[model samples]
Target: MSSSSPHLWSPVRWAENGSVRLAFDQLTEQRDGEPLLLATGLGVNRLWVPDGLCRMLAAQGFAVARYDQRDGGESTHLPPTTTRNPITALFAKRGEAYTAEDMADDAAAVMDALEWHSAHLLGISLGGAVAQRVALRHPDRVRTLTSMAAVPGDATGLRTMRYIRLRTLAKFARLKFPDTPEGAVAAGIAASRLLASPNRPLDEQAVREAAERNVDSGVHDQQAQSRQIGAQWHGPPISAIARPTLVLHGEDDPLIKPGAGKAIASRVRGARLVLLPGVGHELPERAWHAVTTEIREHATSAHHPPAPPAR
Candidate 1:
């Protein structure tokens, strides 16, 4: 693949529970390898991951797949829930009618479409939260679980973080997505700058391209973002997940802090935790190798059990 060109992903759609549809792309380089399904972050699409990283995972003997969540990319559009405004919803955490469990069903539907009976599920941020629900609600179908930069249910840690509040205020203070193409790119660039690792330089072009592709794909509206935010689950605690679980996070994450990751790892029985000291909310290129290594090792260990202890 050329560095100047992005991977051409042809997204096909799958409907779930008669209400939601998701757009997904898959690479089957390792046709029978453990199917690894990725759920992206909130208000974000699969394009958020660099195409190179996706290809790298595919090359490493894994059938890699990623999909847009319900409200982002070319997937289904859910109307704005008007019971509360965005500010109050963010602060008060109200008005969301759906939970990540619903989103996980969409994931199961996608897997059904692909005829994959079970998969190694991995997610980032909000995607990570959804992945947790998938494990909880459909434990038999999840081979292994990897959650990155995600908080547990209710996002209690995030709501308590001062930086999150400040960041929210700053973004809404001057938020605007211009109607033109250039404006869209600009909007993406700004968000990338804000979300990128504080320890690393920004990848402006990648962000710009992702934004442009998302715009071309379909509408990425504020309502969808708000709805997803409102979709935070208030159900059972995270301690009940029985899958081989890995929790990874950036210690410097401003959006969902390292504390959130730690909280999750503590709750899930035998869940492994990895914290990158110099990383942030968004996965930097530098952290991809670490992230992939954790995932590979976790899944491989799960599949290849240790020898018997008897002598």
Candidate 2:
């Protein structure tokens, strides 16, 4: 899938449910020796997963599809933004909240729009949270699960105060500076600086390029992003996920600590956790091979069935 190609391989339109519209781009080649469905992390349009990751996955023989979560990209953004504080909107009390389960439904709706009965699931960061809920809610719809730089909802991990404060600041920044290019650049830089492990510095040029791509792709919707974040923050339990799962985390990840991955793996039955030393929150080209390898292996093992008895 070239950058020049459309954001979605197919036209952007509403699903039968009428609440969510999906836009997706499909890879030209199939890797992992079969077709696979790919979803991007939160606050990202389709361009977040660079060509390197797409090409690598394609080489593995899995057809990759990347789409914008509702309210993030070209997909439909929720309407009638209230004058409520962004923080309050996200952490709504009780009945007023939208959970990760809703986002999972949106994902499944995307798969159904593409007419796929099931897909190999991959999600990064917030997308990982959404994917976790999807597998738990619709286990039969997932062939395998790959969660990269993500944490489960168990809350046993080392939730660093620095990371939490940074996230809160980032949200406020986005709400205040949703339009300025310089604001976008500053936000990305701040993110890189805060989330980057001191041991593994992200490439400055690469971060700049990614920021530019995000800026060029489209405007950020503060309300929608806030709502999604709130839903995940108040998400339900993850004990229901039964699919074969592989949890990947960067040891130096400052945003969601590696401990979160370990906790997630412990709670989910038979889940495998892989900690990548010296890596951070973002999935750069250096980490693509390892990430794709784990995904391919897990997805393959997930689909393989028991052998028949010798007659």
The lDDT values for all models are 0.72, 0.66
Query: Worst ten-residue run, lDDT, model 1?
Result: 1-10
The number of residue pairs in model 1 that clash at the backbone is 0
lDDT of 2 by residue, 39-90 (tens): 6665667666677787788777687777777766777766534523444543
Off by over 4 Å in 1: 1-11, 83-87, 91-97, 154-165, 203-220, 232-234, 305-311
TM-score versus the correct structure, for each prediction = 0.86, 0.81
How far residue 268's Cα lies from its native spot in candidate 1, in Å, is: 0.7
Inter-residue clash pairs, candidate 1: none
Error of 2 at 243 (Å): 0.5
